[model samples]
Structures are given as C-alpha cells and as structure tokens.
Target: MAEVEEVLSHPLNNTDEAIKGTVKLVATPVGTALAYGSLVFMALLPIFYGALRSVRCAKSKNSSDMPETITSRDAARFPLIASCTLFGLYLFFKIFSQEYINLLLSMYFFLLGILALSHTLSPAMNRFFPVNFPNKQYQLLFTQDTGETKEEIVNYEFDTKDMVCLAFSSVVGVWYLLKKHWIANNLFGLAFALNGVELLHLNNVSTGCILLGGLFIYDVFWVFGTNVMVTVAKSFEAPIKLVFPQDLLEHGLEANNFAMLGLGDIVIPGIFIALLLRFDISLKKNTHTYFYTSFFAYIFGLALTIFVMHTFKHAQPALLYLVPACIGFPLLIALVKGEIAEMFRYEESPKEVSGDSNQEKKESEKKEN
Candidate 1:
C-alpha cells in the first residue's frame, strides 16, 4: 500500500496541471496513445513481478522477509489518513511558494527513494555479484535496557551485495535530485511500487475489499469533488508517481508532454492482487486462477481508466474503475466455483496463525485428558 502521506494522482489531467505555469507541450494522437500504452505496460510490470516476490517472501523462513500484513482497522483508517495528508499538502502549497515546498519534498523523497530502490534491486543485484566477490555479512543492532529488561529497537542484516545495490541506487537518486529527469523519477517510482506490493500484505480478502472500497471513495471524492488532489499532485515534486512523456515521438528523449499515474493507484490495488496470489497458493491447486483473473481485471480496469480519461479529456479516479474490476472478477469466479466461503476463511497473518495454533493445542490437550 502507498504511504499515507502521499495522495493518489489521477490519470490524465494531473500531468497537464503538473506542467502548468511552464511551457506546455502539445502531443499528437499517436504520441498520446504511445504514452498511455507505456503507462499500462509500466504499471503491469511491478504488479506481476511484485506479486510473485510477495509469495516468496511469505514462504521464506527469514523474519526480515516476512510481509507486513494489514488488518481491518488499518484498512478502514487508510482513507481518512490519506485525505488528511492530501489536504495538508494542498494547504501548504497555498501558503508557501511551490518551489520551496517542492525543494523540501524532493530532498525527503531523495533519501527515501534511495533506500526503497536499493531494497527492490537487492535480489536481482545479488544474482549478478561475481562468484569471486567477497560478500561479507554485516549486522546493525540497537537495544535499550529498562530495569534489567532489554528491548530490541533495531536489528538489520545485510551483505556486500546489498551495499552495492545501495551504491547504484544512490547514483540514480542523485540523478533525480540534480536533474529531476522523468526516467530517474520513474526508476524510484517503480522501486516504491514494487517494494510496497512485495512487503505489504492484506491479511485476508475482506480487509482487501475494505481498503480498495475505501480508497475508491477517497480517490473519487478527491479527484471529482474538489481540486485538492490535483493541486497537491501538481505542486508536489517527488517520485511518488510514475510519469511517461506523451510527446516522445516528436521530441524524442526530451519530451515534456507527460502522463502520470500515482504509485498509490498501483500499490494499493497491487497488494490486493498479491493477497489473491497467496490465497491461490493455500488452495494447493496447480493453477493460479484467482491471481490471473485479478491480474487481467486490473489491466482492464486501468485500460478503461485511460480510455475514459482520453475520451472525456478529464482526470479520472483510477480506483473507481479498478476497484470494481479487481474485486468483482475474482469474486465472480469464486461464486461460480462455489468457493466463496473458503475464500473468505483464508487468513495469513502471524497473529491469526498463532491464535489458531493455541486453540488447536488446547483442543488436543482436552482430548488427551
């Protein structure tokens, strides 16, 4: 899921607003199609790759690899938090100079984006490390003692390959900071989206529904009901959204006509799709029916968002289209297959598992007695 501090960007009009107060570049029909096509492709890559990685992370014995599961409470409160932050930024932009606000935001995201990119690239970078390389392990530990009780504050483990990934990520981060290049921004945005999907787990289908449903209203209200979302999106200078130039054909690499999509749009729906993948794994079936169904539904939803935005020439809440397709498609399948009950019963949180284990142990003890 996206960080609560960042607002979701709408599909089409945010880009126009983003480049406002500057020279606006016009894009032809072919250029516009290409831009939209690239946006779709970019959005698909992270969700597919991240969903697979999330399954691996769930199965991994390493505690560090374990995903952070979202509960019903967290899902319910997400929209309220996001709306507060969105409006807060809108007010900040109104009170201060956009340049100064973005300067601070750019620096903050610079540090955050580097760490996210490094984490996202670590697995792939590890594969490329030469066999002869000395990949020494390192640990960073912090603890505090209170009346003979010690509490662990931070415990992190890494190796030389991880450092190498960080170094490479830092280079990209510097590039983004110095130039604010579209490609550099995209690099960080992709990293953020992939990591969010891989690390954030929805505990069950119901929680996923609550989250997407809440955000559906949030996105719609922000985009259609008021100008707060558009204002903040245009003013905020960060890699929280992925962007593609619409005039790449005419202007080549220097194209300024861009189209944007929020990482929230990708990451929020992405974690839900990932949860479906994990649910499929639990079924012990040879096929990934739910995963693929939700995946294609996401594609259709996003494509519909783009189509509607293009036809109407207006900004659209991506979640409005995405929520129904993502939730409905897999649900329809479950209903048809008579597995709706089983689908809702599946829970993967550590707390839930421990509770179940305790109950089973008590039941067994009573039987033995």
Candidate 2:
C-alpha cells in the first residue's frame, strides 16, 4: 500500500516547482459526508472481493497459480523495504526531474496495471465468453536441464478468453496513460489492491500481526515524522492509489478536488482478514465471525481516519487507525471465545499440507498391505 495523501488541486504539470504547502478543503457538511462515505464504501469493495478470491485460491488443489506466501521474516522486513523505497523516491525527486520520473512510472504502471486488471477479470470473463467462441488453451513453459533432471522454471496456462481480457485491460490502460482520469486510475488501483490481497498470503496470525504492526509504525513515521511520504505522493503520478473527487456534486465528472487513499491501507490489513476467513474455513464451522469482525473493523478505522482528517484538516496516517482496529477486533473476539491459543496455532502452508497428505496416503496403503 502506498502512502495515502489527499490532493486539493490537479497534479502539477511542471515538476520543477517547489513542494507546495497543503491546501485547505472547504465544502458543505453534506458534500463532505458524501465524499468520505463514498471513499469508505469504495475501500471496502476491493478488500472483500480480494479476500474471497484469496480463500478460493488457497483451497484450490493446483499450486502452479498460487502466489508466493509471506513468512514471518518477510513480514518483519516489509516496513524497512517500504521505508527505503519511499525515501529513495523522495531523493530521486530532489535530484532528478519529476516529469521524467513520473513519465517512467506511468509507463511502468501502465504495463503492470494491464496485466493485473486482466488477471482480476479472468474468472468473470471466462463465464461471459460465448459458448461457440474459439477459446483455445495455451501454455507457457520455461525449463532447464534434460529428462529426469529437467527443472521447470516457469509454467503458465491460459486461453483465448484471457487474451480478450488482456486486450480490454490494455484499452483501459491506454485511457489511463493518456488521460489520467480518476475512473481509469481507479480501475487499475482496485485491480492492484485486489491482486495484492489475493496473492500475498500470511503464513499464520502471528505473521499477519507482525506485518500490520510494522506497517502501522511505518505509515505513522513516514507521514508524521517527516514529509517524505507526502512529498513523493504529491509528485508521483501513477495508479498506485485510489482517488475520489470531493467536489463531484459541484464540478461533476471534471472535478479536480480529490481525496486519495493508498492501496497499502486496503491490501495490508486485507491479507490478515483473508487469513481469518481461511482459519474459519479450517475449523469447518461454517461461520465467518473473525472475518466479518475484522472486515467491519477496517471500515470503522478508515471512516475514523477520514473523520479525523476532516476535523483537523491534516493528512493522517490511515494505518494508525486501521491496524489497531483490524487486529484488536478479531483478537478480542478470540479472547472472549477462549480461542487465543488455537488462533495463534493455526497456520497454512501449501508444501507442508501436501507433504502431510502424501505421508498419510502412504501410511494408509502400507496398513492395507
């Protein structure tokens, strides 16, 4: 998730200008409520959609398509990596031309956004394909060695439906690249957030805690301790964050007054909530208590962030509000239910699960013999 920053004016066309001071937003109470409410609603959509998709992926037998899971160590190190990346971009803006940097970023995200959007649409697009459509299957394989020693480096399977999806996504990508429209930007942003939550797995509850906890500090420090995060956010023109026009009622579709929320705020806590959904599945209780609790907590936290930001007219670190709510709500539920130990012990590792299944099969065969 990138740092969430609200911008008052259109993105600067010239990068050579000095960093401007924050501009105040003046709007009616109803307009303010509507803008913030819409933001909260938009934020929830991706998290829920992504978490559900992640659960399906986790339960799927095929491991080829599953994204790499994040371990405790990776979670611990994420904040540091993010910090470096944030600070590095800040320095790059200082040393180099912002226009050139943003141009490169736009091109990079243009490609990435196309792929992500295509992937996000793949499942739905498959259903919509005409029955008579020539949906030929395709596989991409890259291997090394020979015969028994051959190692498969990459193996991806797709079909014509996927190609169609990619083509559609590319059109949207072009629109975003050329116009930088908020709706086009959001299409890419939502796809990115959905993919992030769906693919990035936390091994267990503890790892999720480590990640959310670390990011909480990272978001707070970068946002408040220094102006690095805000500076990069203002200069960086990419579809990395979701923006809502605050003055939509007044300016309509051409509105430039925008309120932005970083993808990080959605994806980071989202993975944890998804993990709880998985944990609920593992219990085989047909209940989604933990998942729902955390999901609602995320909404509450984000709403709180907006309220406080509105009241103080300052850029507030969303994670400061989100992290505690997401973690605490579920944890409190677990504690009250006397499932704290069980919650901590629950973990999901594909390799280990497969190995154990294989071992059990072998033992059963031996016993039968």
Candidate 3:
C-alpha cells in the first residue's frame, strides 16, 4: 500500500502536477462523470450494504439481539448517498448547459439515475421483504451483552450533534452572507493573531529551539494522540464484545506481572461520543447542551488548525484553504456532545446487570408475577 501510494504520489515527479492533471480532467464533463462514478462505487456501495444490514437487524430482532455498535455501513452510507446525489445534480446541470448531450453525459445520467432508483426502491422493498442475518456463534466487535436470558439489544443509533452542527453552520453561513460578512473570516483573523505572536518569537535567533520543541509537543500530544484515540474508539464500536480475561480485568493493570486494557472505559466513552453526535437539537433554550459540547469540539479543531498552518508555513497558501474545516470539525463535535449530554443528567448512577442466571429466578419471578 505504501509503495502504491508513493508511485501514485509522484507518477509524474510531483503531487502538484498530478493534482493539476486531475483537476483538468474534472473540468471536462466526461472526466467529471468518470470521477464521480468511481468515487460512488468506491465509497458508497459498502455503506449501502451496511445500512441495509443495520436496518434489517433492527426490525427483525429484539433490542438484545441487536448489536450495541453502529455498522460501518451506517457510518459511511448516509454521507455517500448525499455526495452521490450532489454529483448527479451537478452532472444534470452540466448536460443542460451543453450544446448536445454527449454519450458520456447520457451514460453518467443513466448510471446515477439507476443508483438513485435502487437506493430508493431497496428501502421500500426492504420494509415488506426484510433481509435477515441470523444469530451466529461468535460475536463481532463493538457489540455488548446485557447477560439477560430475554435481553434484546439494538444497533447503535446516530448521534444528533452532527445534524445540529450542520444546521447551525448553515444558518450562520446564510446570516453572514446576508450581512455581507463571513463568520469564518473573523475566525481566521483570530487564528492569525494568535499565530502571529508565535511567528515573531520564532524569527528571533535564540527562539529557534523553542519553536521546534513546541511543534514536537503539539504534534505528539495534540494531533497524533487525538487521531489515534479517535481511531481506537471507532474500533470498539464493532459487534464483538471487547473484553479482558478475569485475571487481567481484575488485577492486570495494577499488578506487577503484566497489563491489559479496561473494557468499559473505551466502550462507554466511544458510545458517548457516538451518541453525542447522533442527538438532534430543536429550537428551544432547553436544547442548549449541544451548543456547549460543540464548543468543546471546537477547541480540538482550533488545535488542529494551528498545527496545520504552523507545520506547513512554507505552503501558507495551501494551509489558508483549510481554515473552514478547522472551524467546522470542532463545531460539529461540540454540537453532538452537547446533545448527548442533555439526554442524561450530569450525575449518573451506574447501571447494573442482573446477577441471576435464569429467567425464572427470584427477582425475575417477582417482576413477572
């Protein structure tokens, strides 16, 4: 994979040259069709499969029978569907503007239209003729067991934070446009002011080491560390219950012999982050938690922006283009976290699993009777 990436990176000596060629290709209608088609297949097909499977799992079985994790399909499918739809629209507009609808445009429209048809039809058909994947022997990652005989587990649901952020950002953008000023430009200006001081210090002959050392810490603690943690959290969301052996769980971390990771710490937090993003915010003062969490996410985003701009100072032009993402990603995260937090009290009592092995136990009997 590394070798392939290297070969692709400088196929004609530099990445810039490759990107320019790709951009020229994109500028043409035929090239746009080909590119969009390739991207759709590569990104969306698996997502569609996963979403289908997840929805199927939800409808067919009880909550206990469902996994506690979101499938990759669910995570990727919605985004891909939106992207493909946008691409199809762009293609339609291109064809409309052309002198004559070319063969490439015809083929692109047909294929995209077919994909849209299947995408729509599948869900409706699935409602009546639901596909099912039966309970298997082994578990997959990102799943949990409530350890109850009659337990029903459902797949993890989407977080509302992402939706709120999208809506809020859209509103803000529109407002700024109407006012003839962008909120993003203010953010960029603030970022520039903060970085300017660092730059002045770096220019001093004595502060060279200070700048390099700061960069090292920033990359290690902020960028790489955050990225790694986020990835691991994602892995924990699979259908398989992640666990450590009894010995390891009980004593390994504190004991001298060896060490192992804790299960709940990872799973709980990951689920929180997921749930945070899945929450939807309505227009009410009570729904303000999303705002706070979104703000928290923005802090990390700010850190990321600083790292990007600082690291690529030589390529300042390129770094400047990423300012929007720097602001967006953080705001998005904050929105989700706030929503999820609102659903629960700040002080939560720990949930307990029933200790009884059978459904006909004393506690169970008391409830049943």
Q: How do all models score by TM-score? A: 0.90, 0.90, 0.22
Candidate 2 clash pair list: 1-264
Candidate 3 lowest-lDDT run of ten? 1-10
Off by over 4 Å in 2: 1-23, 353-369
Question: Which candidate gets the maximum lDDT versus the true structure?
Answer: 1
The C-alpha lDDT values of all candidates are 0.84, 0.82, 0.28
Please give the TM-score that candidate 2 achieves against the real structure. 0.90
What lDDT tens digits, residue by residue, belong to model 2 across residues 293-341? 9999998898788777766666678899999999999999999999999
lDDT of 1 by residue, 1-369 (tens): 455333323333344554232333367788887888888899988999999999987765454566788999999999999898889888999998999889998999999999999989999887787889999999888889974396657767888899999999999999999999999999999999999999898999999999999999998898888877877777778998888887788888887767888888899989999999999989999789999999999999999998787666566788989999999999999999999999999998776554565577668878998
